[model samples]
Target: MEIRARGARRPYRSYRTLIAAACAALLGVLLTPAGAQGAPRGPHGAVKVSQPVYSYADSVRESVWVDTGLDGDADGVSDRVVADIIRPAEPARQGRKIPVIMDASPYYSCCGRGNESQRKTYDADGTPLSFPLHYDNYFVPRGYAFVAVDLAGTSRSDGCADVGGPSDVRSAKAVVDWLNGRGRAYTTRTGTTRVQAGWTNGRTGMIGKSYDGTIANGVAATGVRGLETIVPISAISSWYDYYFQQGAPLQGSGPDWLANYVESPAARARCQVVQRRLVDEAPRTGDVTALWEARDYVKNAGRVTASVFAVHGTQDLNVRTKHLGQWWDALADAGVERKIWLSQTGHVDPFDFRRAEWVDALHRWFDHYLLGYDNGIERAPMADIERAPGQWSTDRVWPPRGTDTTTLRPAQGPVAGVGTLGRTAARPGTTATFTDDPRLDEEDWAETADLNTPDKSGFVTRPLSHDLRLSGSSTVTVTATPSTETAHLSAVLVDLGPDTIRDYNAPGEGITTLTERTCWGPSTPTDSSCYRETAPRTADVTHTVLSRGWADLGTYASASHGRPLTPGTRYTLTIDLAATDHVVPAGHRLALIVAGTDRGLIQPPSTTPTLTLDLARTSAHLPLVGGARAFTRATTGAAPTDPAAGRSRPDGVAEPRRTPPIPGESG
Candidate 1:
């Protein structure tokens, strides 16, 4: 094995090969049986056996408080995180030490996990009476302990919630430490009665969605000893990326609001200073400061010892695709054993996308990593991507292989300064300019089809002669200068097809509410593992936004500091569009839109700033399926425009389309 120092970058071409090899070696070492003597279904195939080793109907439900050392609220006492666990009864009597499945989140007592918003329930004695979600009811029967922990300062825990800061991560890390017998836990916040994880085998796996999943990502990056695997669904690998894209602020007053929102009212009051700190620490300039650096898991990817199974929707505008895509790339560089599921839904769980398939895959994933089961999951394909809505395909790796890095430059004469995209670049002196219009929404930027607006510049490619698939993030490099010292730059990739597609940003995104309900597992009176079904909502399509990117022109040179550009003193800025999987069919035009601002996700600037682009050096590089040679050669004799092509809509605006809901997801 290669023994390079941590954080050293490996050759990009060889890292993927090393990841495969390293996973094989790590599997045998990490998956060794804890204790497997005289059992019928020994450690080899523990998960494959028919009968469950433990009983789900009768399990021990309890809570413990773990010490996190720091009192973030500045109280007199140290912080304590609350952990609610459901485990097999009398594990010591059976001489069995079960593995643990934990979900550490801040939403337990407030807005619960999953679509149903199910929260935890407690008895008069303050002990947990029931756990939320199907995790405990499903996994506990299969010999795994399910733990739901309320991060410090949230729910019933002590201390102030610092959002995704060090306190947040340290709180979760302490729970893993306690499970592995390296940390302390008590029956109550300040109780003398101590508790130990004698029922566990010291192997734990974390799983959750959104904030819960973000905890898993943060804790796993600490390289906690007992954490064997993690399943982060639409999780944030970096809080900075969650709030900012490139150097552009995605929203205003996010950090302070989020910090207070997740904490209890009493904790929020006590931590008012901390809330103020959050606001004070936030950089209004959108630069990556030390605060953001501390929350970034990408820099600490090398420390991740646990295997990862990541899930995210490419069209998720909330958490966004970059959160998972960038983190997935980092894990690859770290040579960790990892798998990914890329869907088309917006911020929805895989359970809602493909329930049966999701459960089966998740079951095998835990069995192999948490339990010592040799289920052949390691040899399976690394990625399961939704090519289109509801259409799934498996590949050896993400973005697939054999993609061509195609460069398409802006050519003039299509519509004044707004031009068409082609193989050749426009002459050096030619330029396109636009002023930032905070009033315009994404729909407005998209609907300006006739190039009648001076607020944005648009470029398009003639109807394609054949299908072209974009499988990864596209880079937009432009040579330009802002009219002011500070300005925001927005770039968008578009599909000018005359077909309707899923509108992920819409409410429910086409999912209709149904009266009927479906159950996932056997349930007790306290908890029902079931939900209602939903269907898709549909609309007509004219043009679709594929991927987008943003940047603050002042911070174009560095993220730590901004360098004001002297007006017309050109600076080259390369912005990375979000990663995506899109197919532009035959006779559909591909477009690149350059604008000064995007109001849909960002706050409006106080003043308008104009941007001038030197079209000669400007180009958009896309990772096309057929590569440049194959695509360019294939279209050598093909005409740019097709006679059978459909015309624009009556209002020149393509109506928003909603995606029909597919079966298998619960409402």
Candidate 2:
């Protein structure tokens, strides 16, 4: 939709003002008396106060090795993941327990974390000198202990990096078990000196971005105790969805590549066997094997007792929107208490895009869940969505309350090239044919909407008379006859109009880092809460592809099985596009592009194939905010003279970059 610039969007001065206000408000609440806010009692039945009376610089810093009970590297000894902890010393000295915030990550030593790529640092004696990101600096003095964990096989942890498998998940779960007194911990990796997490109140919260966040999701799904909540930003719900799409490989590399990338140098030789096992077990066929099931957190959502504060970029191509869509749906079905923030940026953290709001919301969420504070955060809106750049809105629940399915079918247009999209179905025998072209991708299909391309079929509706909002995932079902035994198909939903949008293709993926620094909390000589400021990067574009889906025709009947298609037989295939919440502005048309081999995004098929679609049975079922009536009211009008009507190629438009196996060094 054509959203007007919201008061000089993302101005530096405004950010400073907002952050100051939020911090002041938070400080005021924290300084309030314990019983004044009607806060709940702690596990020990003692009334707790949400105040930052402790000193950040004087926080205790130490490390402990938690036994994972797994021999991932076939070593004689059980694997013990390392946990580097920092907590207010006063709490322990006074025998006052505090809640814990843990971040279990494989990238702490290899790829680092956050916008600045801060890695964990240690003192000469092996005690942690600094924990990456601002979590420790910001929350440690605020009555919370922050733990930085080295996932098994990475950093100081012992074992093989199994990528997203049992080793990866259980290693982190072990730390939670130890904190709750269910597992054992040692002062040293090999020493017999037992250690206890006695300072903790046995309540914990996990938070992180990307892979770090992914581990939190996995651990929470294990039904582990003491993990009271999780804040997973741009995290994966399923490793299968991360590497593949509907039996179609999205990237050439598998779990083995990622495992090798994050394995510690000390364990390289020992981890080779585990790496080989990963490659052998994870077949490139994109089948749902036992290895994938072990990593599929969505299927195990029922086991999650931890309240989730999920954050994801709607346009995130790395850990695609499907991960969040499926996981969120599953969480809802399981009756899990959840909240989400959907940003317009790509593979980005809210800390970069909406820093002030993110920090404030997170503080409240943690206080409510982990610290037993009745701050009314659960009573707030369930969703905070950035509908447009720098413009946010909230809803009681995601996909909006009145959302319903609206099916739009393609019918033959008067001319030969493009088709008309409307409520009425095409005639029984109507058909559209297109041959597979490995060179063209979703970008090519979207840009050449007015042209008749040999590789794709375009269907467009009349310009909308009013804005039509689409709130959730969409399914594109096609009954097609293929000329080959196996082929690939891609469907993309596009907004055909001129508008200014976040430049997701930019260097920072929709954000430009500024030289100005903003500190969130108290800093030490070795570590600081200060970080470079950022503003949304914008681009004027003729069209924006809202959602895209790809699938293998060989697995048309089921995602797990692949059956050869008869040359002349008609088969129905369902391609589930990623979820989105977007509004097609008035005077803009909604278009659907059905194509083959979305290069770069999906692995190309072995052979090219021509497919003919039975237009009568082919339709796009979308979750429209107001359903069919809303769609009709918006689209029923004399077509406006589309600014892009005669353009054969769009300007300032680019396809979503295929995120590499390693999202980025700064992830």
Candidate 3:
């Protein structure tokens, strides 16, 4: 492509300039005019980011890269470049010393780089994942300037990636120095802040999700001086516990992900180092202590000098959801300002959020901490929304000091609707079960294991006749018996639809999908609760969310709240099935499905533990919203022929019944 600057006499000369300019063009979308705050969608109904540039100062253009010897990534970009400065944007606010927010993330390969493109086609409808952001951008905009830096040896930078090791730690620090440096350096005809803050006012912070988040936490542990505040969302604290040994062989995600995004020298050379060893070695169960200790974030959590606002989805199988407790404790012990937000959200995405909001929040945080701007971040809630019973709440701490854990039970048979091969329950006398490998052919190894399905039979309280907002963490415990190696369980709290419920986001696209459907993927945590550890385990999988926290800055309690289940209206709490979303209304069954293997879903850990399940004493402990009763009758989102049968849930008392686990033999 012939390249030219916005104002130039000739085409741009350097590829560095070209790439930086393109990134400036792309990442600069945060500059869009302030009036339209909601997510902008294209004609196809996907997120649309508008570009709005304020000033073009050419004097600040300069390149800041230090060559780190071990170049695992051979791309023209240096290892130090990848690890240090992937996409460094200049301070937007003149001499005010705006806070610098830098984050590193694993990029999906666009052209043979091990990076996996969840959003391959720019089209919203066709993309496997949505949005233009790497990972930090998904929610960073609520209050921060998100700088997505590729770790060493990954993309267009240099050196081999250390996957959160010391090399990565030092490189991350180098980038931090570059961000705060107010010193002078080379300038380009093109107005891009490639160099010099040049010396910063010591207002620097690191934030990121997943892999990026892992590094953010690691660097924080090193007691990096320049590193200030951090928001490590869905971080991989205990790598082995969360990545591999959690309960599966090959830990489907880490392997498939490395295969798709971090596989080799060319891939490594193209950017930074390939994660050759991190994802290469197969995880050996019962022997994961070595790996876990190696990746132990808690080891350094206490040493981290920077204050942190940590958030984790209860259902994040990819990361140890329990890390929140440890990280929080470490921060507290270190006397570092600390905060926590846990939710029934998943490794998927936190609802009640828009990209811009996330960006805005991170900005406010950096401004307040890094640049010393009193952005009011500290005044906001310290902890909030592990799950709202129809409305959102803000607290000073996680699991808030005075909060109580309530229980909601399953009162009906687990299965009723779709019985496999004509059987409703796996009766004691019959062999009833579904094989996972047979269904593996249809699974998406990338995200399925972290989020899979075990045939579940359950029900929700009757839907409310009126709309009720429910936002918070949720966990469902099932005493299931599996003849096979394991029993995978998935839970979803669907808004019994047909009632007008509105949130933001477009349809079909990745991020949009969460907002598009009245139904949500299992936004619960997969922990000791979600997964019972007894030989014939009775695991309780809990997932939760805290929308209001420093990590997630400008949040209104209302962001996650949606209409609650209508009174007396029937709603179904589905357990196992393909990923699907739609409205289940009042007067209809709040359907809950339980099964063995689901299409396109990787099964949970398969360690043979055949056992019987008990029901009478079992129930989901949830914060039921007051003023709303169990749905008396529920409406199904099925198309009807009759004109009078309106698609609306009927209101009444909510009552959910749980049936005995179909006692069946392993066929």
Candidate 4:
């Protein structure tokens, strides 16, 4: 094994050959238990497994092609399929046929394919965009053909890329057939025609992000034998739960815009111009259309045959953390031996050097499965990523699979105080109460959200005397009922007192800060201007919380499971603390704000789907181990000061304002 320090870049042409040679000498073909690898069928019915040919900065030509129909009698078919094949751009030292690696670009043409990313997405270095873009690039040089196809109707492909995974599976198969079929001579690299490898042992795999990552689930569902392993980054396990939780869209209009971009008419039209569209576009408005529903990998997640190394970001606003929950459940039930990692990184990490870390991991993954080289990846933690204060940790399984479950009940105390953890008194039935009229004011936004102060919550403050690491997405199941048919809920975790909250909020004023409360000073109890943010989140915030916009669930009246907290009656409200990793200085206390609204990120409730917290049926679930790591808030050993200036939201002089109730609510 070559030992190199961090950030060291060496030419791989020679190193790859060396690694291959070393691998060949040490391990021929490791023995495996029967059925564990399933029945193997190679190219043309014979199994032939050979070492992969890795590429180190080789000549690569980016071209587009039109795929003619292979089967004509299938009701309807796409005109042409577009593909992006990366072979050894120039001649290689080894004589090998193209071992094509085909990947599906799920929803490649969303919104409007017409104006895809501009500039052909070339980097400043003038090199065409490359893969290993997010994960590790170290492995690609090891003799693997990388093919990213734009399916039938998306991008440069021929037909359509429906929003569904089934269509995506078909799109993938089409490319797989093309690469190994008669077209082998068409895709040439250097001086030799490229052919599929792994046919020796039938080991082929795919790696991708977001929509692309989802194709692994679809392909696996088909029970296809050619697939070997998959690396699903920021993957969505179940579209239903991803887009909607508890029947209502957990996310708001944010993702709809993105989905439209993936399958929009404009992108479709552009495919016509470039002949890049893939599968035929599915008819919209049909409840039965595969795209409309059933995108959830969770439903059939148990059937996946491919070994998938699932990685996701704790702060991934696009796909969120729940994807991990659902996918893990499916894989576990199916008894699939898998590794899960939760990252603090953003979605799929397509751009920037931050993605470089994934390279180290990918090299290890491919080396183990594709080349049969064990590089110690199997012994790595199931969940691994940077932890609080820039440190990192790993667990055997997600949620550690063995961490003790603890209940954190909210009780009464000053929102800000030189306080204690949990609650002051630990009685069996502990509770905290605060009065929230239909009106209150929020002048600050939580940095926790991808949107400016996306979290919908309210807070009161006390001082924090010590720093704390508040990490991991949490669950708060409180029995709450609104006298009115509908209301919204916003829960926040804040650092209160002099230094903590001030220190945390000051970041909002960063040179030119965002969000309403910080941008615009806090307003009157009834003023909505202070609540609106320049960049709002996706959830509907209108009625219950004084959000920038409104989403009404309607007052369904009673929550069948819980009692209604009479407008004047004593009732319990629950708050889900946004995960954080900040240091609270000696003079500050972490403030946990439980409120009804914070525009953008979240808001109260509406009818048709009013919320009810069952006090009798309440609990809070926090995955304490190996999740999002809290930060070192007091690393500087100093307190934070107030913002020099604050920005406010646009105020309509004529709009009526609502006021939050003071601590007193009259019966």
Candidate 5:
């Protein structure tokens, strides 16, 4: 493992120029004077650092059917998942093996991938003519094979889509096994003509966004042998968390709905039974069942041997932030080598927001992990975070280094309409109550902070003298008495002030695509490395919802099942809000809004129950970057009057759907 000189690198004007330079350098060192093609070599015989000496236009493109052990579609034979491959022709022709980069997805034939909504295009002989995204274009020319896998029951694959279940995971895992010479694969769907992945050196890296990335996480959790690393961008670690918040369902649709949406037209009739099972197993009660356990990757994190490069957005309401929060923590506990990038956008790919940097970082990560290059990427900062729109920062670890929990309790304010939040707790017997209102939401509560709203109780702190940074998730604990047997509670943490921030509610979800294109790799007749550039969309707002969470009072003791509560009986419910990294500027106040039925975010309970909170026992535990001392200093200033009364609505849509919308689908 020899270290390369980082300062010797320079940015090329175009990918073609970079490829030409790499070829000249390689030819000067290893190839014959006649320029005859041979096995790809890097100074020594090792596939250490990747160089674009291979031709993307001349890459070998083909497809194979990897057999999965399970028959998810109830067919007599085993299911065979399709893997569309594009690799450098030189290495394979000369009998020299290369590593692989795979993106196993259910979206290839349905919703498509990336900002351009590009799907896989095949030629007449069933060979892939154009693979979606730039992975094939860039990595294929850099001595790596790019595998675009269609998940079981989707696209040209056999079996049924299980929505992150065993079939979905096993379908992708089998491909890795086949590349390592363990699993069986065939050249045709029904034919017995066998195929072997002799071109691969058995080192693989998986990468994708959303559902595709979720597959990467699932496969990595299986501890597959050939997989060396994974890059899961805004992916889900647990399917239950995606559709449910604690014991409450976030939306009406379940995993069955998503399964149907991505199921191929040819397999719809055969996968009907699978869809029915998804519905039967996942009830509206949001209980943790065996079906959900199988889909949860975090629980099996200990088995993962692959290194991880996780990317997620803090404001992503579709897949939500808890997925990354929990998954990152699990990976850390298991002592897995990892890196992270946290953006300020909503359910967006990094390629759409930070293209050049993303490509370079991904290339370096794959080179170091899969190609076994000692490029010092692993020794660099572990976390790269977007502090503001277009503003970035790096740290050795996430949540900063010295983050600690700081508890803030609510007390009576000078004004009778609102409450005060500070280090001191309220009087022993003091209490505040709010009734359930299905129509109101976090936005409505944020607007009426100075008013006495019947549906919500607002608590605000005095004007801060210094900026206070919150680095991670916060917990809201409420000792409350419910008016009914069942109830729903929602807690929101808001930064009450005027500021300009990313417009995450916009049509593009914080990115405006431009007509100008940037080419990343070589081009062919149908497939090209060019894609539209994007700019960040920003908005001026009076306040921003930092984090929020929901909980079912009936399931206060257990998330597995609901136990009916006695009317008027006091019980403590702890709500874990989504993870966030935000700074409350000086002079702006921080507010906590506690309400029932946060309208579009979660489904309301059948019975509207009023909750009376014992203020002395209720508190919010915030993960503050500077801990309690910094908070005390920031809040030492004299109290100010309540914020101005106005609409103060933020830009973008009020509520994001459970699943992000596809190009032609309704949100």
Candidate 6:
């Protein structure tokens, strides 16, 4: 791939222009073409961007409402997604078409985005006076148009929010279509006047954090035209996974409640009927319904043509690591070009975690994808992962190819209650049972004790002889019989040892604000050029929960329907824990705890559940970064392998359900 140069090379004439431009830059005033008024053009006729070129104070700001053809609010008018555009005045006015960088978000008028939770500010005339964060202030002067859009039903948009459903996806997709002159938009909800994205080059890129980023993923899945690339930072790939994991309902409210909560009060009032419809569509069983399928980009990976740059936090309990890991795998299998940055921080943007490096990398990414500039980003490392807090490493591919999947089983320990995990399977008749307790929280479960009774079960391995890195999703398969009709089984992977690391889930953790600052882009008088410094908020932790998985026993056989388990009949339950990239030091121990009814994470059943595990058939398969040989060599002694390894039927039993293709797309 060659970098595209602007204009024809003119020897001495070009040299003189460059020298003159440099001299003017040192004087603090820039020289531009006779008709233009912003940044000066280069000798090759390209935008000459100095360090921090765009001034938010000087950029053009405007707004337009794009009609979405749906009367989501039932206000007798079609819904209109509001867009706030900021562009370099000179080039834009001079007819120099520029690529667009857009963020379609629902948080504009409410919870806000970024560390400071900045919201949209408006002038007296109802025009957007400020677009929060640094995109517009920094990128406009660099010859790009930065657009901040209000997802329909939020802020100034005229509609009802649908969470991650069709209305939400279409709100962003329409903007991309409009940029390419293929969609209809208007200046008002009921106005006859139409508006077109006349100044754009028709190529667009979408990016955001959280729900904003979720819009980008949803829009890209539509295979919409003009959407060239996307940078989804800690975004949700499947709304189903966001609310429910492996049939376990993680949160109390469903999409209907979420949709109403994100909308304006007026919108909620006007769209009450729509809200009811949403509630009717989203069931409480946590099944993967068609509603979720429509919102799942992972299911439509084949429809994607836009290149993806994914950023995620390994410790993000809100969206979790599996959301990105499973989506990334689908993108890879679909032959999508992609790059990723897997951080250790919890639900954070890279700009906060690694500012300077993030800005430089993002600049090159936009230049290559949106502006069609070849900046060698395509040749860079495919994955950058945090091995430990403040420590990072790069690899050609995520999870690193040829990873060894080591399956380990639980063996009764010398003590009555405690047990040991190793490569060897336990005796056929051995069993460990746990009763469900709806009152126990995650902290209670993490601090395992009271094993004399059956509220929970715990299994641990001896101190590792060598450092081991777990790099991908771990699968836990347990054969058991539940005493109750239904149960919610929770599986947790833990690092049991004394250590000091960032407590991502805790408020402020141990992070301290520093006096130093870093600049990302040009700032306007309102938004500054710099942000405060931040580092990991460390804490002394005796045991850290690395990953978790939950399964509703009723939905184990099929994710589409729920059925009570036969009273005394034993059944096989297999579930995949969230993915991770953590290094366990040589002296540390690894543990897996399986229990019922996690009170904090999900709504537990009213009646207690007693689960009796078939120790001979229960095993956890781990994706060790070290190959199988390395794991075996580091152990104290050789252990038995799975008797069903590589066979048509694992241990002579057939799969309960035609397991869906890893998360998204239908088989």
Q: Highest lDDT among the candidates is held by which one?
A: 5
State the lDDT at 499 in candidate 3: 29
Query: lDDT of all predictions, in order shown?
Result: 0.73, 0.80, 0.38, 0.39, 0.81, 0.72
1-667: candidate 2 lDDT, tens digit per residue: 0011122112111122111111111133332221123445457544444555678888899999999999988879999999999999998888889899999998888877777767888888898987887789778988899999999999999998887788989999999999998999999999999999999988999998888889999999999989999999988899888777888888768878778788899878798888888888789887878888888899899999999999988877777788888988998899999999888898788888887667667877888898877766776767777756786667767767778999999888888776888999999999888999987878789897644478888899888877778887899998888998888899999999888888876666788888766766777777766677788888999999899999988888788766778898998989989988887877888999888888777887777889998999999999988899988987776644653332221111122122112111111
Q: Write the per-residue lDDT of candidate 5 for residues 1-667, one digit (tens) a residue.
A: 0011122111111111111111111122111211112324457654345667898888899999999998998879999999999999999788899999999999888876777777898888888988888898778888999999999999999999998999999999999999999999999998999999999999999999989899999999999998999999999999888878788778667888778888899888898889999989999888988999999999999999999999988888777788888898899899999998888888888988877677767877898888887656786767777766776666667767678899999877777877988999999998888899988878789987644478988888888877777887899998899999888899899999887777876666677877666666677767867777788889988998888888888778887777788999999989888888777877788998888998777888889898998999999999987799878977886533433221121111121112111121000
Worst 10 residues of 1 by lDDT: 17-26
| Model 3 lDDT tens row, 475-568 | 4444443443333333334332232222111121111221111111111111000100001101221211111100000011121111222222
**Which residue runs of candidate 1 sit more than 4 Å off their true CA positions?**
1-53, 414-418, 449-452, 633-667
Clash-forming residue pairs, model 6: 153-159, 299-664, 299-665, 510-537, 511-537
Ranked candidates (TM-score, high to low): 2, 5, 1, 6, 4, 3
TM-score of each: 0.87, 0.89, 0.52, 0.57, 0.88, 0.85
Leading candidate by TM-score: 2
Mind sharing the TM-score for model 3? 0.52
Better of 3 and 6 by TM-score: 6
- RMSD to true structure for each model, in Å: 10.3, 8.3, 17.4, 17.7, 10.1, 12.8
lDDT of 6 by residue, 1-667 (tens): 0000112111110000001010111123232211122323357764433333544567778788887877777778778888889887777667778889999988877666666567777788766666777677557767889899998888888888888888888888888888899888877656879888888988999999878888898888888988889999988888888878777777767778667667877777787877887777778778777788878889898888999999988877667777887888788888988999877777778876766556656776787798776445776667777655665566667667657788988767788988777788999889988888887855577787324246777788776655566777888988888887888888778877677766675553224445455554555445554555567677788777888788887776886667777766788878778888776655567887888876666678645779898888889989886666645544543222431221121111112121111111001
Two-way TM-score contest, 2 vs 6, winner: 2
Expressed as tens digits, the lDDT of each residue in 1-667 for candidate 1 is 0111122122111111000010000011112121222323444645353224565567888899998888887877888999998887857578889899999888887666665556888889987766776787667766888999898789999988877789989999999999999999999988879999999988999999887888899999999999999999988888887777777777555577777777888788788888887877777767777788888988899999999999987767667777887888789889999988877666777775566567667877898898877666766767777644555666666667777679999867655655878788898698888889987756677776425268888888766666667877788987786777667788888878676554565654433435555555445666665654444444567887888888777766786566666776788888878888776766777888888768756655545788788989899999887688745643445644662342221111122132334333332
Question: In model 1, how large is the Cα lDDT of residue 622?
Answer: 92
- Residue 402 miss distance in model 2 (angstroms): 0.8
Considering TM-score, which of the candidate structures 4 and 5 is the better prediction for this target?
Answer: 5
Give the local distance difference test score of model 3: 0.38
Model 4, C-alpha of 465: deviation from truth (Å): 12
* Candidate 4 displacement at residue 604 in angstroms: 6.4
lDDT of 5 at 498: 86
